[model samples]
Target: MLDSGLKTQLKAYLDMLTQPITLVASLDDSEKSQELRSMLADIAELSDKVSFDDAGSDARTPSFDIVRNGTDVRVTFAGIPGGHEFNSLVLALLQVGGHPSKTAQDVIAQIQDLDGEFLFETYFSLSCQNCPDVVQALNLMSVINPRIKHVAIDGAVFPQEVEARQVMAVPTVFLNGQPFAQGRMSLEQILAMVDTNASARAAEKLKDKAAFDVLVVGGGPAGAAASVYAARKGINTGVVAERFGGQVLDTMAIENFISVPYTEGPKLAAALEQHAKEYDVDIINVQKAEKLIPATTPGGLIEVQLASGASLKAKTVILSTGARWRSMNVPGETEYRNKGVAYCPHCDGPLFKGKRVAVIGGGNSGVEAAIDLAGLVAHVTLIEFDNKLRADAVLQAKLRSMPNVTILTSALTTEVHGDGSKVNGLSYKDRTTDQIHRLELEGIFVQIGLVPNTEWLKDTIALSPRGEIEVNARGETSVPGVFAAGDATTVPYKQIVIAMGEGAKAALSAFDYLIRQVPVDATAAA
Candidate 1:
C-alpha cells in the first residue's frame, strides 16, 4: 500500500501520462493495473480542455487535445517532455492559449493591429531538444492572438509533413507559407520577423528597390570569414545574421582554432566581425534571411530576401551557416545548461577542474571528452545507452586506464538534478538491469552529435541524405556561383579551423568565378 500523499502525486503524474505508459511497462502487471485506474480518475477531474481517449498502447503515442475557451488546440504529448523540451512545451501551450509574456506581449501589441494573417508551421525532430524552445515561442504567439496561427509537427511522427516541408533538421519554422527560420529562435527575433513582414507589405504598397553585390547568409565563423574575404576582394558584400556569430556564440571557448592557442568563442566572433567591418562589409545584425532566389540577370547573381521585407542582390552567395548541438530530451536539462550543464568539453572542461562531471553519449566525441575531462575534473562518469563505447580501441583503453573515470554502459539520462540555478547531479536508468541511480556531479557535458543548418536550403540546393549541404572539393555547391562551407556543408570534421579553411576555399572559388569575366586581352596583359 502506498502512502496517501504518494498515491495522490503518483495519480497526478499518471494522469499526465496520456499515452499507454510503456516507459514503466516493465512494472508488474498488478502494479500497472492499479496505477492506470488512479491515473484515469485523475484525468476525469481536470478541465474538459484535455483528453486522453485515444492514447495508444505505446507510451510514445499519447494523443491528447487541448480545448481553450471554445477553440481546440490539438496536441499530442508523446514521450517525456524533459530537459529543454519541457520548457519548449510550456511555451507552446502558452502560445496556444494566446498568453504572451510581457516581453512577447509588447512585441505583439506593436503588430496586433495589422490587417493580414501570418501563419507559421514548424517541424522538429525529438533528438534535437533545441527545436522545442523555438516551437514554444512561436506557439505562445499563436495563443495570444488569432491572427498568427502556429502549428508544430513532430518530424518523427509526421513523415508526410517532413517530406513535404523538406525538413532536414529539427526546429525548422515556416512563415507565411514559406520556410522562414531554421533552428532555435528567441521570442524577440520571431516578433521582429512579424514586424518586418508587415512593414514590407506596407513598403510594397509604396514600391521600393534594394540591391547589393554579395550577400552572406549566416554570421558564424564561416559567414564572417566569407564576408571579410569577399569585401577584401572589393566585392560589395552584405551579411545578414539572425544573431551575429550564429551557434558558436553559445559556445564558451574554442581551443582547436589554429594560430590561436585558445580563445573564447564570443571574443573570437567579435574580432571576426570587426575584421569584416574593417574590410567594408555591411553587416545587419539581428536580421534573418528568409529565402534565396536566382537573380534576373545572367551573371550568376542571386537575390537574398530578409524576413523584414527588405531584399538584396548579390553576384554570388555563400552559405557559411554552422551546425547546432544535439540535445537530450530528458527532464531538467535546459534549466541547468551553462550552470553546470554544458555541450563542449574543450570549451568548458577547464571550468570544471577538480569537479565531478558526467559525459553522455557512446560515440567517439563522448569518449574523447570524458578522457580529456578526466585529466582536468576530479572525476568523470561516462554514460552511454549502448553496451560499449564507440571510440577507437586505443582511446577506449586509455579511458579505461584512467582510475578517475567511471563507465556506465547501457545507461540513459532520465533526468538532470539541479538546484534551479545549477546542476547538482543526474538520474539515469540502466537498460539491462532496470535500475535507476542518481549520481552527484558538478557539471554535465552532452556530446551526442551535431545537426547541420541546412534545412532551409532543401529546395534551394543539393544536400546529402545526412542533411549537410553537398559541396565539391572546391567548396562549390550544385548551384553554380552558390557555395557552402563549414559544418553546414558535408564536411567530415566539425572544427573551427576546418570551417575557416572551407570558407577561404569558397571565397577563392567565388573569386575564380568572377575573374573569368575579365576580357581575354586584359587578362593576358595582367
Candidate 2:
C-alpha cells in the first residue's frame, strides 16, 4: 500500500515507540479493507514494539484502533488515513506508544483533569489541510484520558454517514452524537469549549503575569515575526492570540513566499511558532483581545483587555490581529454555514463531489475554487459581481477551459436557500437587467476576500475606512507606544513576507520609542 520511500520514512518514525502498541483493524472483503490491511501489515513489520491484530469487532469496517499495551488508551481511524491525515496517524501511534506530546504542560494537566466522558467523531476529507489539526488534537486527548474517545472518520469513505449527518464541510466534529463544531479548531479552543471553567482559570493565570516590554497581538506571520524580533533584543516579549495561526490556519497553498520555493499555510505557521519559541518570547494562545486601553501617561504601560476578562499590560503593543474570510452577508448565509456554505475549496470540496455547486466571486480565489471544484463536482457556476473577472489572466484562462464550469459576470448573490437541514439552491441578481435568477446547487463556496480582524480596536486607535488599523511608515499607530502591522494594518498587498517585514519594522520602531521616552523625573529636573 505504501511506496518504498514511504516505507522507509514510516520505519524511522516507528522507531520512536517507547512502549508496545497494537493495530486492531475491523475489515471486510472490500478493496479499501485490503488496502488498509496491507498498510497495517507494512507498519507492523517496521517496528518490534508494533503489532497488527485482525480480531477487531468494530461495526465500522476498514477502520482500526491504535491501542497501547494493557491500557484503556485507544484512538481510532475510520478510514485509510493518507494524504493530510497521514501525519495524524503517525502522531497517534507515537503518543499512544508513550512518546511525549509537544503540547504545553498546563494543557496536558487540563486534559487529565477533565471529568466527563467525551465521544468525538470528526468527519474529514483527505485533501483538507485543516483536518489534521482537529484529528491530532482529539487523538491526543483520547490518548491522555481514557474517558475521552475519538474517531477520525474520512467523509469520502463514509458517504452515507456524511449525508445522514448533513456534514458538508471538512473537520466537522460531533461530540456525544451532537454537533460540537464545524471548522478548524485548536486543541486549546476545543478544551475551552468543553471545560466549563477553563476561561476563568486562564484569566486568573494571565492576570498574574508581569508586564511585557513588547506585547504583540495576534499570531499570524506578522505577530510571530514581531514576537521573535522583540525577544531577540533581550526584552520581555509576549504574544497574545485568539489562535496562534489565525487565518493562516484556514489557508492551503502558499507559493509566493520568497526564499522558500513552496509551502502550505499551516506548515509555515508552525515554523513561525517554533522560531518564536527559540527566543524568550512568552506565547499565549486561544485568547481573544476585546479592547485596547492606551497608556494613561507618557512612558506608562498600555493595557490590552481580553475577552476572558483578563488584562495584559505592556510598554509597547504591536497590533497584528490579521484578517478573516469576508462573508457574503446575504440572508441564510450564516444560517447554513457548514451545511451547504463553506469558505475553503481545498478542504470542503470533496464533500460536494458529483453535486452542482457555485463559487461566489470572480477573483483569484474564486476562479481557483471554481477550477478545482470542476474536477470534483458535477458542475460549477462561477458568479462575479463585476462585468469581468478580476482573477489573473492565467487562472481565468484555465477556468474557462473547463467544460463543467460556467462563468456568470455582473451577477450579485442575493440569498442562500435552504431546506432548514441543508442548502438546495441560491438566488442572484443580474446587474444590467435587474433580473434575479436561482440556481439549484448542493453547495456554495464563498471566496470574495478578507476583512481585517480590527473590529475590537475601533474608536481606540485610528482605523481606515475598511476597518484596517492605520499605521505610519514606522509602523506606529496614531496612539504612541502602540504599533500595528500585517493584514489588520494599512499595509498594501497583504502578503506573508510583507507582513513579516512590517512586523519586524514595528518591533524596532517600538524599541526606539521606548528608549526615547524621557523619565518624568528627568523632565522635571530639566
Best by TM-score: 2
The per-prediction tally of clashing pairs is 9, 0
Which regions of candidate 2 are displaced past 4 Å? 329-410, 414-449, 521-526
- Candidate 2 has which clashing residue pairs, if any? none
Candidate 2: what lDDT?
0.91
Candidate 1 C-alpha lDDT tens digits along 56-81: 34322322233353453433333333
lDDT of 2 by residue, 1-526 (tens): 8889998998898898899999999999999999999999999998999999998999998999999999999999999999989999999999999999988898999999999999999998787677898999999999999899999999888888988999866779999999999878889999999999999999999989999999999999999999988888889999999888777776665656777866777888889989999996899988999999999888889999999999999999999999877999998786577678887786678778999999999988899899999999999999999999999999999999999999999999999998755789999999999999999999999999779999898889999898999998999899999999899988887677888999999999988888899976887788
The TM-score between candidate 1 and the true structure equals 0.59
**Clashing residue pairs for model 1:** 82-330, 82-331, 83-330, 83-331, 95-139, 95-140, 95-143, 98-143, 98-144
Point out where model 1 deviates above 4 Å. 1-211, 253-267, 290-298, 305-312, 518-526
